[model samples]
Target: MSTENAAVNFSELVNRNKQTLARLKESPRLLLHRRDGEDLVLTTAARAEQDQTVVSAATRMLASLARREPGGMELLLGILPDVFPWVRFLPEPDLHAFTVELVDTMRAADSLGNSASVAQLLITWQHTAEVHSDPELLAALTRDHAEDYGPATNPRDVA
Candidate 1:
């Protein structure tokens, strides 16, 4: 089975059901593009399970490496720039914090079979990096305001 994901219009699958199933034989994974909604992924249950297993194993290995080796986390932090170029914008302390959070979140998310959480964490960190990368934004954010804003409200409470 080809490892590459093949994409086809959602209509193609709806109109040519048999042909689409045949395409699956050539490529184990398929991305169904939809005009009006979120795109859908199609793959065999076995393949999905295998992918989850691989991700889980990798997460466990990463956790183990960080725990067992001296200066292990530093080693991992050293490679963050390569994995995410935007991380270069983060200050040294923030960068270290991000790395620790990322590894922990990855391990937790993988264990729960919830990759979405990992993705959200990355997005949140990337946006933080973006702010740090912009000189004006960083200065504006860091500047002290004399104005006393009233009580702070918890975001969770608003919802």
Candidate 2:
């Protein structure tokens, strides 16, 4: 075999692998690898969609509780990091707003087990700018001032 022919064959194999990876990225798909005697075949598989059963169950629980308690959205945010660790990096106020909007959407629609949508909602919310400025509003949100390092009383009297 000539070097040119070998290079062409290598490029073809690379293209085939790329196609397989692309296919595996959509939902869930698997290729069959077969081997008989000396014959061999390569296959690829990936779980593109994460298992949402547990997430849905949690969302259902939140929805049921929200139906009972008006502050269910707040409660969910209070513990959102337990499930979505990256969300902890987002500002608390943005998260609060995101949770409120998601709760509203979930309530408005007949969606009780759509945590994926809720997560997508958070992703959308994160793209926006932060606007937590009002002290009263921040306090009402159960969060302290962002830059309050002075003494509670007048610090002028301190040496």
Give the clash count for model 1. Answer: 0
Write candidate 2's Cα lDDT for 11-118 as tens digits. 344568665544433424333333333323332322222334445555557677765778766688888778656566567786776666766765543254345565
- What TM-score, computed on C-alpha atoms, does each candidate reach? 0.89, 0.35
Tell me the deviation in Å of residue 147 in model 2. 31
Model 1: which residue pairs collide? none
Local error of candidate 2 at residue 52 (angstroms): 8.6
Give the C-alpha lDDT of model 2.
0.53
Model 1 weakest 10-residue run by lDDT: 21-30
TM-score of 1: 0.89
Which candidate number has the best lDDT?
1
lDDT of 1 by residue, 1-159 (tens): 687989999999999999997888889788999999999999889988999999999998888888788988989988889999999999999999988888899889987899998899999999999999999999999899999999999999997
Show model 1 residue runs off by greater than 4 Å.
149-159
lDDT for 77 in candidate 2 is 87
